[model samples]
Target chain A: MARVDRSLVTHLPLFAGVKPDDLEEILREARSARYPKNSAIFEQGADAQSFFLLLHGHVRAAKTTPTGEQIVVRYVAPGETFGLATAIGLAHYPATATAVDDSIVLIWPTAAWPRLAERFPSLAANTLQTVGARLQESHTRILEMSTQQVEQRVAHALLRLAKQSGKKLDQGIEIDFPISRQDIAQMTGTTLHTVSRILSGWESQGLVESGRQRIILREPHRIVVLAERSADSGAA
Target chain B: MARVDRSLVTHLPLFAGVKPDDLEEILREARSARYPKNSAIFEQGADAQSFFLLLHGHVRAAKTTPTGEQIVVRYVAPGETFGLATAIGLAHYPATATAVDDSIVLIWPTAAWPRLAERFPSLAANTLQTVGARLQESHTRILEMSTQQVEQRVAHALLRLAKQSGKKLDQGIEIDFPISRQDIAQMTGTTLHTVSRILSGWESQGLVESGRQRIILREPHRIVVLAERSADSGAA
Candidate 1:
């Protein structure tokens, strides 16, 4: 049995229209689970039996190639819902999700989705909106990958991360999580060596600072300029 | 008053569960409209007032860049839906849709969608499934464009078109539409020169037959082999 956390109800976007009492009712159907750093929650092609709501920490969603190259599609933060395959009527998970750090999540049975959607039209509407936004974002990324250069892609991605999960620090905006150069390379479709070289160049120019495991954007405006240039040239 | 086309209802996947009489009731609100080739049915950034079902001919959904470069994202055929922004609860179309050829389409007012979803939960489910499939396809395309070679991408696109609209002829499986080298180039994210050169190479090898505006797949097996090379290299 999952402990009823009132604050969790307020965080999930799917529960926006759900009254406090109704949320409690829905939460009763969900169980809370915790994962340690680098733990695999689900693997690709596995039966998608449940959906999840992140309560604390971050999760990385990734796809692997036959050659074992991993591409990090996106990271899910606390207050977001994932494993939407059930809502979209998929039988299997399309990608693997792993905990980036110690994380707590609420899991709901797949069977409960339709019943909830029927009882609360707003839930369906919100799910549709979420899917729509994700589709749009994916489309934009496709357009960028098809047309933009790698350096520009890196700059844009950094900006997006800053917008989504940046924390203001004394020197600059720090990405909320520890991300490696390899992770950046995977996200931007570039080599890790290239990402390292670019970051070193930026660091020398006072555009960014590299910590042991994190990156701080010291000059966002300069990175924006680089992104714009890459967007125009269609080269990275 | 809109003329209710009973036969047309059978073509739509959403109407599969609906009785013939129920389909008639649904079609009663539909109005048929004709659009000339190259005519804009709906423009990006315009208020989305209605959704359309293609009854005859084809339409191209495209986005225009700031510099006026147009990129066609999708081509809709008979029995497919367009202007789906309404289904996603969006107020504006994100891309412009134009008639690729003179087309006849059945129009449904945006106001009707909510009532339809309420009255037919199956309809909503079916529509959502279609959207989900499309989103998955888009993601697949993004992955391909990001990682696959241009030749493999073009081959994949051709195979997809053949699957969707091929007509078996005495010579081979003929793509049942007039498509130009430039169009293929755009679809495959390559230059017209590159597409033309590759097609010429394939033509010389008797792999395909290319005429003024038609493409005949003389050896789909060979093309499939080429496409598989990329797929085997680790794209799913």
Candidate 2:
């Protein structure tokens, strides 16, 4: 069992409002581990033996469709929880979680949930809050895909990524991760060619800078305007 | 403070493990109300003062995008819960919910959430399960939209509705509600014209029976095949 420092998770949302002693007890049930970059922590349809809280680095959660095409579900940031299939009543993980960078996570066996939840009610409450927020985000993504144009959806996807993990730089806000155009295409539900063309057009218009797997938003406000452009104005 | 029968909620997924007396006590904190057909139960962005469980009727939850286009988020069936902004930590409702039929719902003020959640941990657990299931469904929808053709998407949408509220009959399984093509179009992220043309083709093929505000799947198995058709085979 890896030793966990109380300070490592004192500021995280999952531990919000928890008493110090209870926090220690909760941490006792969790085992911490490291995952290398690009390693899958869990795969879709695998038995969900444990749930995790990311203590460091980023993770990508993705789903493979019946036709074998991959869809980027969402990216998990530090301090967020993932692999919660058991909490949601699923026997297996619905999507795969891969470490986007060398990451540390605190894993708790699913069996401990009932006892822990019984002893510390806040655990259930916090998990509910986390799941609720994700549910709302999923609804928003569905709405965007249903109503918005491809470019608008792509813009929204980038903005969401920037908000989640962007770093302020001298030039502009960088997405703070090595993300390829193919990843953007998967996230936006478009083809690689279409995503490349759209990013190229944005580059010429001075809205963004992109190369290889790096992206920097030169004019995020402009991207927002483009994302919110009305259907009439957005029509080709 | 309208009367709420305990049996009306005992079988619900939200109250699955709640004890009978505890259920009664929970019901005591709630009020029941009726919403007329096509009435707005709650509007999007409204102050979310209450959460509810439908006792008898269907509700449509929708989100209006920034550009003023409405996207059908999901439909709430009888015995299901909705309007839980507080549990998710939102001060305002994210979407508008409207009655599709004469409906009765047990209403609980948002202020009671913490108390109820503390008193009954199953409530929180069940709600987490509900939200998680919806999130999974949303991911499935995203995958479909990202990879499938419009026809396949439409097929999947209809099949989903049929599974949710289908009424088996001699001819076929009816959708059991007044859902128009425009609603289906909005649900599947396509234009009305495209939805109409596709449905017409399906009608001609004897795969479905669709009229003004009704749809019946004459050949559900065939529709499933179409919905699962690989992209290479579904291309026009």
Predicted model with the maximum TM-score: 2
What lDDT is obtained when candidate 2 is compared to the true structure?
0.89
Using lDDT, give the best candidate's number: 2
Question: Over the stretch A40-114, how does candidate 1's per-residue lDDT look in tens digits?
Answer: 999988999999988888898887765576777788888878888888879998889999879999999999988
Residues B7-28 of candidate 1: C-alpha lDDT, one tens digit per residue:
7658678676777776777788
- What's the lDDT for all of these models? 0.81, 0.89
Q: Could you give me the TM-score of model 1 versus the true structure? A: 0.92
Give the CAPRI class of candidate 2.
Answer: high
- Backbone clash pairs in model 2 (N, Cα, C under 3 Å; residues 3+ apart or in different chains), count: 0
DockQ of 1: 0.50
Stretches > 4 Å off in candidate 2: A232-236, B234-236
For residue A106, what is the lDDT in candidate 2? 94
